[model samples]
Target: MPMSITLPGPAPWGFRITGGRDFGKPITVSKVTEQGKAAMGDLRPGDIIVTINGESAAEMLNVEAQNKIKQSPGQLRLQVERWVLMGHLCNVNLVIPNRPLAPQNCRCLHPKPIPLHPNPSLAPRPRRCSHPCSSHPAPPPIPGALMLPSPPGPVR
Candidate 1:
């Protein structure tokens, strides 16, 4: 589900939307000015812009999206898709007997292509609980999932 975010307008909405001129690329929220006009509006980096002022963003080029943002009247209404790291890319099953906790064969579940971070760090292999009671190791992480802040703590 896309979220609708409205911010007071005029020039300098305090955020920027960026995407390549490539036809299928997504118009993503590239940057947000901290403590600026858009900061309090609940906008975040990497949110995909779906519509601008009720106009389909997919129909416009990157330049057009920039123009629409700059031309907002009183308020800027944007429909954006938030990116979810977990439960977005693939399904993970930790208990694969005789094999690595996470396998590289997981398939991308999304039909539309999502943009990745410009520089993604490789995630370390998941840790298995040495406690004998736990039969399986931790679930494997996606390739660049090092961004995960902390473990979920004791999975049962």
Candidate 2:
């Protein structure tokens, strides 16, 4: 069964959303306020928003979707994909997983590698091959089977 929520205008939907790779991907529900319209409407974290006010949310940017929800004065319709768990007695309950946090900034924590120059002369030199076969001429091919090139040497 689908849920339709009617919320007051000019106010937020009371949920946090994270945008996808592009506007084409469905935005995920990152968090839902405890006493907000979203919680009252049964919106949960991890729900993949499908549509808003009959418009396809798959192609909507996070701000666009938020704008659409806010534009509606009296009512807002949201279609989302949620997970349901089935019980032994045939009862079903919506599962709200823990909200995912924004990715940590680790670039500053890690040591930066030496930057290479754009000029070819300043770039790192090609490693010299130590294998005898790499520098030596191929031996005479055997008659019976086709010969395939040897695989590259293993990494250090």
Top model number, lDDT: 1
How many clashing pairs per prediction, in order?
Answer: 0, 0
**Per-residue lDDT tens digits of candidate 2, residues 7-120?**
554467788887754554567778899999888877777666777778777777778877777786667777775432211111212111221112122211111111112343
Task: Pull out the clashing pairs in model 1.
Answer: none
For all candidates in order, the CA lDDT equals: 0.57, 0.48
In model 2, the clashing pairs are none
Per-residue error at 55 for model 2, in Å?
A: 0.7
Taking all chains together, each candidate's TM-score versus the true structure is 0.55, 0.47
Predicted candidate 1 versus true structure: per-residue lDDT over 78-125, tens digit per residue: 988653332222345322212223323444321112222222233223
lDDT of 1 at 105: 42
Lowest lDDT 10-residue stretch of candidate 1: 147-156
Q: Which window of 10 residues has the lowest lDDT sum in candidate 2?
A: 86-95
